[model samples]
Target: MTSSRQQYIERYAEYAMEQMRRYGIPASITLAQGIIESADGRSPLANSANNHFGVKGTYNGNYVLADDDKPNEKFKKYDNVGQSYEDHSKVLMAQRYQQYVRKLSHDDYKGWAAGIKKGGYASDSNYVSTLVDVIEGAKLQRFDKMVIQQMNAEGKQFGVQSNPLSNNKGTKAKATGMNLPQSSYSMPVQRREFMLITSPYGQREDPINKGKTQIHHGIDIKTNKDNVLATENNGVVVGVDHRTTTGGGKTVTVEYAREDGTKTRVQYMHLSEISVKKGDTVNAGQKLGVSGNTGTRTTGEHLHFGVINVSADNKLQWVNPAAYLAEISQKGNLNIEAQHNGKNILAEYMTAGTKAVNTDEQTPENWMSKLLGSEDAALGIEGGGDKGLLGNLMQMFMTLLMLTIQMENKSKEEKMQAVSDAVINRHIDISSFVPNLKSAVLSINDKGNAVLVVNDGKKEYSHELTNAEKNSISNILQSDSDDTTKRQRIGCIVNAITFSYQASNNYEQIEAQQQSQQQTIQRR
Candidate 1:
């Protein structure tokens, strides 16, 4: 078995790399996804059906029941591995992945992979890392050489076409790889909280000295007139230091550990003043200290809110706090109206700025509203409002759903929890799926999970769920994450998902890419 696995893996490395070049996916990721999904091409799905990618039938269309993808779970079958490769490439080139395409232009694979996961291209969380592993292990540099030769021989010796299918694996060098099995999740965390934007995280002067010689490790967040730096959660004050900062200057570190073992360290860097001391336990609303322009940081007075992952070595791993600070919702996502120049303009998040949304005629405000309820337009749905009365009371109900955005405004930390949950909970607004959503959130538990009391605008749904159903939800939400790479995909199609990939306006992303690359090299 092991020998056979090795044989197929070697074949996959050669095959996937060529496919990546043709499809524009990173060869490394393509190799990795094959290893993980097809079990080194030994699984029944790959062995029998030749459907090595294990794509599924979706709500929109296209499905086939194959051998390995669970009893009822549909999988895409192919005539042979060649066809499978072609399908994979075509899927990636779909309109849903425009941002993915742009990422490729910059050769930023990490950004592209993270963009895939963050864009909900896949429910898998470690989608990026998985790809990274495959790329490295396969030593895919070997595969890149074979590409031009194959292309040169096309129609004569290669007998290949000028254009490959969008999802064709041989075309995408990066799809070479791309997380978790299953889980018994607690109730889905649903949140509705007030959010105020003071300043963005990691905004600073040039981190790198002219793109060479020196690199900035992080961005700075300016604090508005308030001297208060609030907590992301209720925990203990960890440190107050005045020296030894590569970028943060004087810093105040607050470690917030929930009732569960989920510990998050919020570091307020370059603060001029520190009000809290070490070992002092604080609440979520407690003021930690005033923001400042201290240390080696040259930016004006700003609060640097940094999310640090505590390594087992007790070292701090800095992560982007925008994900931890803003109450940005996921999935059913944000119910937002972009107010620009006194007029309402639809906008979408972009790598540079929020670009004007150019969408089809069947948008929510136009057509989709009539097909499904905003509250029930996704997986594990909850219909809002009284069914018969919804039409009669459309004006009143719509007014209230719209009004909730303004009615309850809260701190940044609270918004963080709310948006995090909303993002994880599919395509429903926190408020629309659950009434009293602000109060429904009991607390986030360990393992980054939370329980919620969800009410679809009218009545709360039954809280009871079997272990199997609960596991399904858990598997979907906390699947493996993607790795950070320089060769990225944007607006590329994957499965049926089309997405817009983005990176930091600041250079924090560049640092992140370098850091992750170093880690990958170390593992090798």
Candidate 2:
């Protein structure tokens, strides 16, 4: 079946909203220009060159010969639709469009459109009216509303107070039977099944020095994985200490804001590697580093996790890591299994004073294949489906097409072209939906047929599966460890769909891009 105009808008709405957040461009203006300039995403230039908005001249030493007002004129080409969209945003910041940037708010689509035309973006007499018709008729202004809501929820403006952990404070500390600490709370490392708490946070015999008892301010957690994860939400990396001394070595301290707007610091120490530097923003569950015995005081590979709260009068108090993790663990959700390195690994949430063992899966790779296979069965193609490739690619074209629509202005277009030259030429693969996937669910429909629902945050797309597909998905979900949450199960199904689809349609392109990216890093 042929793609619809509405499908184009829906597919790229998230990307447009993200651009709006990053570049202060109205989502409405971005979407409107995309529709009109790309002929609802069916333009030849868009299809062959990934050049939306008919941007002219040499872009990064790459040029596509296309007929515009004259034959064989130069037009800007992009590697992906996302790059085009980003370039469009940058183009609008040029000298000619600087007035619009200064005068218009990010949400004012009308002002942007008027400013673009008055600023001589296009030679066509009806450019302004055409853009207005597209914006108004499609209710693209609603996207602007979505952008604002997302930003407000994130508390990025207006001095509005925010709490990142409001939804994550799972259970009360008393319920876990571990005496709660006076101030501050969180798990040092999440999914405790893979981690063993070797040392508790209290007075104990020093493992490093023989005999004498010492007051330990931190808990020691041992894990097989080299990487470490953040414990609290809305955290900013405040300090990084790399000294190899008596204290824990290679530490990263993150400052977190509490409900009352006060701040506390969580420290992860004894690391083999660190992923964050000072002044970098971090989120809870973000990978920070690998566990290692880096300090003179440490005996083996383990995480020395600690928390500190400061009073208004400059007093300091240490919080018990063991009790804090136990309390938070009692209220936390079950762990989800994520696919990494072709393995199905589950991050297990631990209860107070309990230890967990690995599941009975003989091999993780075999399990990953079983779960991912279900996705292929549902799509009704081979193990890797081809039925959806054409459609996916077409939609990708439309997406890229809209991204460059705002680049028609002469002065900014030239500037964008120059910048594109500085960055190496690359291409976007439109045949895979892996980048947008959030979660998916597979279940029996009213008619008893297996159906799959894929969520990309903004909307859900559903497809019916074959009988074989239903059985495969059900079996995979049921076979996972008991610690896996329902959300994790759904996530498994969604990832399986994406992995299989991309493998079948765009595997080579994906591999090439990865290789190219690696080379780019090597060059740098």
Candidate 3:
């Protein structure tokens, strides 16, 4: 006799896998979330309405009243459990969840769980942890493997289509068989041989404050006064900071626009001199400055390079510079306009590189054998005849995999150096603030308070945000408003905070003056 959990898996595994094939959601994640949400198919909602995912709203003009977070909530009432699974896939197919569905592979259930939770699929803080636990405990990853294997067998690519509700800009390219134009990439420092990296990206000992670990946002390349620092791509200079005492002295930031209308920014720091000012358009390999030890954060003469993706709303996210450069190097092009697939090329390269490193046994030969059943099947020929068309395709695939394997063999330091050489920085404009804040860093304190640090080009102000202020900022960020609307709302909040600070300071000064006057009268 099998447990109810096992019975649940046996009954619904096919539906989960089918959904994964149709959509890019991991079968493991769907099954685990289903198990948890529907209580192993024993919940009242599941029994009465056949809803396995607790998906809200009516389904085919049918819904069941259920208590979920709030009393008397209407949960979608599906005709059958399979329909529930399909509905769950459709729910996640929304534009907001496209980042996970399109980016992550079918086997990456952990990423799927974390991404969905971060996308606000659930209000529960432990939603990701719980989903991961269910996936691991039930061994649902096998279902994900099954779907991927089937997809491979059919020669079907494993990628999700764009959400129907989202913008349909790239659809024409797919239909017409014309590739979208891609931005070219290059190394920041021109060199004859592979550039020597002084410091790599990721967690490392803080050079200035020894022993303590900190995230090195960018990699440091070994250079001298003679080595010229250059822009990695065709872009316009957005920022040039010339503070030699500390913090990335003599920084030059250039922003490159991608074919998808997104922006990538690269920053070259610790330069001895800057050749371009803000608003200057420069081509790839154009000289920006000379590498130097101008910053106090550095131990020697080198260029500190960093890259970041800038969203339309001005939010910044760091990219691994080393992985990016390694990708460009592997492509054997110093400045080649590669095809854009409506996704971050650097992110895809990093993910593929990591998979190649971690699973060395997954070679092209092994993959062909597993998917095609035998060498004979892969060759698609009989009696030792000429290699067939399938065999030629297999040969091409093997050659590609061999190249990937070679790339994987590169030292970690080399990857870091490559990425560092391609690093870009984005400049955030906070000039909309009442005091015209130049920059702002919002973070939470150890005490669970929202602390905001804003610089007004002259002085920096740190303020512990109140609940209302925090909510206002959070709401503005989470809204589906345009960039201008978001920025204006944020400016209002900043203005309010600054006014409050000024009012408190003035009140304190008046009180102190009154106290001083009282003390003088008492002495008289």
Ten residues in a row with the worst lDDT in model 3?
A: 163-172
1-524: candidate 2 lDDT, tens digit per residue: 12456866855555465567666778888877777777767788767766667778766777799887899898887755555666676676677876755567777787888888777788889887888878888888877886676577766542121211111111223432223234422345554222334555544567767765554677776443346877656679998887778468889888765555446667888888888889988765788887777888887667888766544443444555543554444445423222222222221224444433344432333322332232211222223332321233222222232222222353432333322211111122211223356654433332324455666565556667654654553454345444234235534555676556555546777888999999999999
Clashing residue pairs in candidate 2, if any?
60-421, 79-426, 79-427, 79-428, 170-331, 171-331, 191-348, 226-290, 228-289
Model 1 worst lDDT window (10 residues): 486-495
Candidate 3 Cα misplacement greater than 4 A, ranges: 1-185, 231-233, 330-332, 335-524
Task: Return the lDDT, model 3, position 134.
Answer: 86
RMSD of each: 26.8, 27.0, 26.1
Candidate 2 lDDT (Cα, 0 to 1): 0.55
* Residue-by-residue lDDT tens digits, candidate 1, 1-524: 35665676645554564455556565555656677778888787777667677766532243466444356677765544766765766666666764545445323455556755654667777777876665566564434434443445544222133332222122111111100011111101111221222233221224434432211223343233335544433467878786636567777777755333445566767676677888887754466665566777444554555565453444343443433331222212343322211112222222123333344332222322331233221212124334311332332222222233323575433433333233223222333223223322222222222233343243443223234533443343234432111001110111011111122212566888899999999999
Query: Candidate 3 lDDT, tens digit per residue, 413-464?
Result: 3433222221111012244344456766544332333466677665567898
TM-score against native, each model? 0.30, 0.35, 0.34
1 against 3, candidate with superior TM-score: 3
Q: Cα deviation in Å at residue 468, candidate 2?
A: 25
TM-score of 1: 0.30
How does residue 284 of candidate 1 score in lDDT?
48
